[model samples]
Target chain A: MNGKYRILLPVLSLTVLLAAVFYLQPRAMSYFGLNLLFNLAVPIALATIAQMMIIMVNDIDLSVGTFVSFVACVTATFLNDAPLIGVAILLASILAYAAIGALIHIRQLPAIVVTLGMSFVWGGLAVLLLPSPGGAAPAWIRTVMTVKPPLVPMAVVACILIAGLTHLLIMRSSTGTLLRAVGGNAQAVARSGWSVTKLKAGAYALAGVFGVLAGVCLVGLTTSADANIALRYTLLSIAGVILGGGEFTGGRVSPVGAVLGALTLALAGSFLSFMRLSPDWQIGAQGAILILVLAVRLIFSRRGRKWKGAENG
Target chain B: MNTKAKLLGAAALVAVTLPGHAVADTADKRIALSNNYAGNSWRQAMLESWAKVGDKAVEDGVVAAADAFTTSENQATEQAAQIQNMILQGYDAIVVNAASPTALNGAIKEACDAGITVVSFDGIVTEPCAWRIAVDFKEMGRQQVEYLAGRLPDGGNLLEIRGLAGVFVDDEIHAGIEEGVAEFPKFKIVGSVHGDWAQDVAQKAVAGVLPSLPEISGVVTQGGDGYGAAQAIKAAGRDMPIIVMGNRQDEMKWWAEARDENGYETLSLSIAPGVGTLALWVAQQVLDGAEVPKDLTVPFLKVTQDTLDETLAATPEGSVANVEYSQEDAKSVIAAAK
Candidate 1:
């Protein structure tokens, strides 16, 4: 419910996670351990924070997966020292994403419908841009991804910088507070003298910015970006948001939680692969973990409601 | 929407035109070889060779052309759609590198039934109706293991990193390896792993099994992904003298001639590029109404440092090995056959 209690959740969780990591040791350190976990955290952290930004305005932007994947592929293929063209493309793609958000808000379409349609369009355009996966990312740009400087992964640094910047922006501006208010009660916020549509679009623009960052992370981790990469993360990012307690209805899903979820999944994969357990079981187990975590939350919420009601009476 | 539909609709119209053209004159027609997608270098070489051969066809009007339909990869459904479009566009014959060979049966049959010939290369379709062009992958595996066993004649352990599982390539290679190893008593396979033909995953798969595979005399893998196995072996500082990969003639030439700057001796041989080429020829021949036998096995070269030949250096890029035919030679062969 509060800081210490929230800290306990991850702290206790990491202990169990670390214990399992040691248990699975053939070399006493698995590929999915701290370093890899931190790497996994980078993309999920950026994306979840981005998603949370949109959610804070009670709007959803489903095209972020497409955004990141498209940006990564384009960056790999087109983000060159042409200097002028690269800047234009980056600005264009961001504006395109923001424009999609604005249109949906203006039309008053359900975020689910508009964003879902936007995903198909964004993904279609990505495929059209780079039909195959031959292109290479710029050497200097990709250099940030492949190495760990000063014992910290480039991904970890990227993640921390993104998180810190996001924190600073939202904390410094009234826009962040307005967005949260809109999420809690859109009608009330609009009545209280704010342009709800603009606020909602700003939230989505933040998601777009985060999507661009995720694309950068992708280029670093996987030196190549293809059409297939974007398709997989569509659902994975959503899962990250929900798993990190980022409400679909617009609430804070801690960036840390999203990173942890990604790390846990990657570690689970590494563990199963190490054991020579067939990948089938690995997939089934991951799905089961998701369902189990959600079910536990569902049960706890019911109990929480009952306890609160009893105390109030 | 109307403009887009009209353009696509017109393209579709032309694709269906091949069948009618074929009916009027099968003896000499502009034959188009329409294919789904060129996703990899293997398929790239396959298609490029087909196009070159088509260009070199003897009869002036009886030309061969290759029309690449889509750039998308691994989308079987899109691939099937392309096939249907080819049929409608009236390509007199098709050389299919099916995404899922089995899933392609219905469409392949539709084209064949309409008198537009269809033959599959690279990926063998489930349909028995279409001829499979390529090497006996089974024999290639056998040959691979046999070569390794001969090198380590006293019989030693092997770490086998396989390709994408469940596909035709893996299945045939696995079967061939098993068959070949059965004959060699000294050969004991230590570990078999799947890397899904992904370089990084294969590298890790090799790393994971390396420590336990101390007795390993050789490492064998699906050729394209073999670099991954080789990288892992090098990183581990294990000098397992035998390593094999997919045979691109150009690369094989490099391997045979490669002077090591990093100080590891280069032991290289040409695997078989001929398999995919042979498959292409078989498809060509069958579509041309030539009676091919039940199946054919494209040959493999087992070169060591001892057998390194400068003859390989003379072999031209994009030219098929042992295809000695010139324009006149092709005409003579066709005339004699006729």
Candidate 2:
């Protein structure tokens, strides 16, 4: 319930996971090992931040996964071969996301239904862009992603920057307060003379921007792209936001928490694979860890409420 | 509910085919293809191959019409629905690349009862009445492993990039790899990860486990991820091991370039997308009342260093290399089927 514990929970969890990974594979402590372990985290963390932005507005984008894939498709194919056309398409797609936000607001439609429909559209467009799963990522993006900083891995640095910048923008700024107010009490915020539509649209546009970054980083890491490349991101991002002390429709989220949540999940997978477990058990084990974390959070929240009740008594 | 629809659909099929039966019996057969999914280049290549061969068959008067329908949904129910529609269209034969091994059995059986010749290939069904055409994937895996073992005869660390987890093909190929690896006592598997037979996924997985693994001497993978695995190794700045390639165009291109520059010798082999054409061939033979076996096993095609250039030349820029069988080749395969 305390402000410090709010941040400490996810941070501590990430630390424990990293410690375990290092323990299991001691080599993971090295720069190269850490690089390998966390190389894919940049995109995942970016996706988590993107989803966090949507959740802050009490809306979910079911299409973020496919949208990221679509961006990657464009990045690998058109961006590599024909820059102007690819950049144009990417900008158009982002603007479309903003328009979608406006459409949802003006029409008073359910975000889930709209986003679910858009998922297919995005997936289809990605398939159309790159029918096959072969294309080279632009060289500059690859170099930036693969850069080895002195102490920490580039992935860790990217995660820190994403978390820090988003935290400052969304958690420390007045505009972010307005965005959260739109989710927490839209009518109240509207009565106070701000355009709720603009705030919500802003959130979606930011989500789209982060989604594009996620896609670019992913293609950079993988050196190729496919329509189904980041398809799992939708669910993973939702899970990351929730795991990082976020609430649905409550407008309560933390950027640091979201990034750490993504890192935790990503590390959990690497840990399992590093242990050489069978593929069947690995998926099940991931589910089990998620359930365990959620259960612990539930127990802690209930205990916090009970402690408050005792004080009131 | 399904039975009633099947009856009505069968009735409609009979009503539609009654007039055409007289002409089709003497002239040419009408064939329809029901594909389960079209998300990947492999499926696209298969469909294209089907179209090419089907058009040729039509021109050659082997059949009156050849039609292909693909479902975007990977679910078997969706594919079954497509097959039902095809049955109502009164096609004389249905060739299928099934989604699940058993999910489409009911729909396929209904087509069979309607006197439609059903042939399933690649992701084949277990229904006993239909003809199943497929290359031995287990042999494909074994042969790939054997080839790798020969390259590293002194025994070395191998990293295995597996296909999709829980898939029948993934399990079959993996089992064969295990069997082959068992024979070569010196070869050691250092690490194994499921790539889901996808490039991006395989690259991420291989990158993740690379640091913890022993120095990998060779990499083994299913198709669709060979180039990805190679990229991961190259990025790690490790020596490029002898990677057993899946017959992807990118892999072939990479191998050809590598051979040209460094004299690196590596072979590429896979389950060709031309299996679709083979399925068409079997359907044609059966439509012509040839004695085609209920189950026929086609051998996997192997492309060595000598043949990589030609295969790459034939493959389109961003597709897998496919081995299309000629009409004569199909007839011989049918004649030799046990």
Candidate 3:
């Protein structure tokens, strides 16, 4: 019946199971396995948190996925022919994505609506940039992301640090409180003399920054940029947000929880692929798992709330 | 009695398809051709050929109609559903490049039970009912390795990049290599692994494996993704003269030409898909009662940077078939080898 118990139990269960499985399957410790986990886990988690950031502000950024896709495609093309241009491409892309969020804010439209339309625009733009997935990621960047550089996948560590910072900010700031208040009751937040629209726009822009980081990580792991990849990652990222104690109506999404959910999905995907399931069934099974997980979550939430109500009475 | 009756009926109709002209034609027969959607140029070409021949037959007053549905993407389930749909629509004949060889077995069998003449192309059928018209994948693979061994007389190191693991094609290709290398004991197979048919995946696999075997002298690959292998070689800090071999993807052809013109040591024994195209043509003739070889291979090209000029000079500039093998009405399988 504990509200906290509902959230903490799954985390505990997953941790224990993963520990046992990792011990049982030491191949999970192999270089390939580690690279695979490091590849999907970081980006998927970053995208999930980015999405949840917007949701926490009572808005959604459907464009995060496609925006990342475009960034990935652009980064690949720019980096391929000119390896030295990596940093500039990344910074410019991040700023552009953030600017897009600012535009959505200034326009005063729903974040969901604007981002949904922008998703297609970004994907189309990705096609315009890279007609196909080709070329190699810069050796220096690839070494940092895929190889065991001075600190392997410094990007993964950066994301976790960002998550901690986001947590700290939510706990310590008035802006974070305003975001929550808007999510729970927009009109009430408006009465408090805060611009709900501006806060929401800022939340979306922050989310875009997270998506940009994820795109950078992908650029490192993959040699080429593909326009079609994010088409699947979009919904899967949303699923990660929901699984992280975030309501679609929007409230209290834990960044840590988002990362954990992403890791779990990544591991599951690695398991499916390593086990050698046919590719056709792999996608179907992933989709079905998403549906089933969400359905189970809904059932657990309903039951937990009912038990709490009974206990209080 | 009914089973015997059906077999007798099928056997009696040696001249199938359409009636008339010098070639056989029912001129009124109907055929249902189903293909997995043309997601890429390679697949699109397959479907175009299917439609071109079918349309010609229809226009020539041979077949009453050629009913066809191209599945979206490479989805096997969609293709199975497509075949079942074609069966329900009751076309006289069906041709399939099944999405999954095994996944489509039961459904393909069901199509056969429905009295549809079935021919499978590219990929084989899971069920054992249809007439299997296929390119000699094993021969193609073996042939490439033989060419590679000849070029790399010393054969210090050769890396083999495999296609979708466990597919019939992969096995055939691998087996062909094994068969080809059985004699050349000096030419060591440096390393081999699967690339899963994606350029990025191939690149990563190559990247991972390349560091371990930096002394690799040559590379072999499946269709289209040889660029990844070549990229991996450069990434590994080795400019080892590599003999890269693969087929398909319009880009690979241009890559081959450029590699040739640049005088790179790469040899694109790109199996001009010329052989498979001819296999289908012979199958179509057999379906139409025209006598033809039971098994045949049209031709394959092993063009290199050295031969690029010669190959190009043979064809008219700016033509589709430029810098390639001469396409001809092949009657039987030939050496197609140097």
Candidate 4:
């Protein structure tokens, strides 16, 4: 598959889904309707980007969901009441992620096992921080998320900004090249006078930053936080990355595609609701849409490979 | 019929004489609570109720140990594994708030086969081997509409806010609402959305559908979603409707303020979070050799315009209105069931 056009698949999938939603409920084409349908997409896109960062370094973060929930808990409670302490704790948590990355590199540990264990740690901390799910999001964040822009909704604007900035930081930067090189060929990159450990740690820290943003955005939309608020994001973010033309172990990721994937997934839920399917099949219908998109991506990638083979022959 | 009556008579006799003797019989038995999720305020309150009642029972020598365990994720398979662990740990009895009504049957059968007493409540199991203290969720749903029908005799459109989809409770409540709508044909249901039994989720769902919906005269909700619906409706610049509330403190508080401001009136109802303790005492009773019915029903807690203030005062801020059942309360409930 050509790297240049890898992003087309996610874009095509998103466009088709959006068209279906707008067609079924024509009211969704308007500004108010679009905002209502995609209001929650900002946080989801941010989380996907966070997951993409870790994937770019050839590591998976099983703890992203609970880690995000932990961040939301902190943002709603301490960040609302004591801004300095909340900022301090958030920074410390990012440092903790960096340390985990270094430890994994130094000790030759599996990323999956460490992140899986950390999921529980983060979940427990969140539960302790807000046992009953009754903390308000900081006032400023609520205002920022709910602000009415001129044409596009805040959700759409935030998504574009996130995708554009992350693309620059990741796909168009030297540090990103170093990070991918570490994932692609750690020994070769090490021989080139680079610290592989530092690169991995930096990637993880960047992921942590995006994860915090995701949490904050989510709470801003919800107006409160719960310990289990973002527990589904771990799988959702992974799915978004895969849907956006990311490989499992090759450090192959596309930032623009990931944001589009997140938007597609969020819109799919609204699509199902608008269809008014029986409640029994609503959840199953969501699974079917996910599978349908992935199957399309699969067919396209296969065709791309076959075309490449024919050209070479 | 004769045999059934005979069994009932024998159960009543046992109940009359077993209170004092049952304590001694169950003193050495250890019990475990297998809860599936604790991510919400209702669940947090439920767990607190269990600890309070279970610890008191232990100190009073009703049982040797009563420990609680909860799964991190609300998945049936994980909860099944937890139940198996309880069986291996040799708990004499297990009281559970199950994740699924049927998915946990296999693990529950194993416990029954191991001669362990099982009592399921709230999110009750369907396994015949286990005893169930089930809520009449359908009746709870029906009564919400029944109240609306009474309040507004000239029927109008209702917006039904359901709980998590594909769960037994959600389906039962929905069926009840449908039944209510059928019985009162003048009252129509124009829209419905699954709130997943959380305020934030409910608010989002209601807001999404409100744009496309007709003016709703009443909102029929499965608990934990009334306030969210109110907020969404208010935001949409619509007239306030009578929204049936789940007994969350926030909802009750909102109801109180609305009443003070504009003389708002509505009904609030839910199963008390402390129903876990009732299941606990039932397990202890079963282990004490009392002949108990396979199925039992617990009444849903309801708050009317008259009782709102008193209930609000009793419920802690950010928690559900709750009532922890004592041993005597459990005995009476069991007696009533028999």
Write out fnat for all predictions, comma-separated.
0.00, 0.00, 0.00, 0.00
Residue-wise lDDT of candidate 4 within B1-338, one digit each (tens)?
A: 99999999998688658646677678899999988888778788999999999999999988999988876558553456467556655689999998756546656766787799999998887778999999888888899889999999999999999999877789999999999999888899999999998899999999999989887899999988999999999999999999999999999999999999999999999999899999999999899888899899887888889999999999998888998998888888889998
Q: What is candidate 4's lDDT per residue for A1-313, written digit by digit as tens?
A: 5676679988988898889877887766777566656666788889999999889888999999999989988998999999999999999999998988898898989999999999999999998998755577798997898789998978688888988998888888998778877777889999989988899899889989999999898777666676877777898799899888887776788899899988887776666655645434655887888889888878888899999899999
Instruction: Let me know the TM-score candidate 3 reaches against the reference structure.
Output: 0.48
For residues B40-107, could you state the per-residue lDDT of candidate 2 as single tens digits? 78888888888898898788766888877765446443455456556645689999998755545656
Candidate 3 segments whose C-alpha is farther than 4 A from its true place: A1-3, A9-13, A16-24, A30-32, A79-110, A135-140, A147-159, B1-338
Ranking by TM-score: 4, 2, 1, 3
Lowest lDDT 10-mer window, candidate 3 chain B? B318-327
lDDT tens digits, residues B1-338, model 3?
99999897786575453243324454555676666655555554545555565666577765677654654336443355456545544466776666544445545665677666676756655356675555676776677667677877886677888889757678877787777777666566788878775667787898888777747766666655676766666677877446455543432455655565675555565444233344344444445665543234435455656665565455333221222111134333322311
CAPRI class assigned to model 2: incorrect
- Worst 10-residue lDDT window, candidate 4 chain B: B72-81
Rank the candidate models, highest lDDT first.
Answer: 4, 2, 3, 1
* lDDT of model 1, residue B331: 29
Q: Model 2 over residues A1-313: C-alpha lDDT tens digits? A: 5445557778877888889877776766777566656666678889999999989989998998899989988898898899899788888887888888888998999999999999999999998987756576888887898787899879788888999999999989999889888888999999999998888888899999999999888777656676777777898899898788787886888899999999888777766654545443655887888888878777777788898899999
Q: Which stretches of candidate 4 lie over 4 Å from their true place?
A: B1-338
Predicted complexes: DockQ each: 0.02, 0.01, 0.02, 0.02
Best of the two (1, 2) by TM-score: 2
Could you give candidate 1's per-residue lDDT for residues B1-338 as a string of tens digits?
Answer: 99999999897677557542322233343344435455545555555555555555523333344343332334443344345445544566666666654435545655676576666655556555665554566877777777776667787887887888767778888888888778886777789999886667888998898888766677666665566776777789977457665544443454553334343333433333334334444444555555555333334544455544553554456322222223333223334444
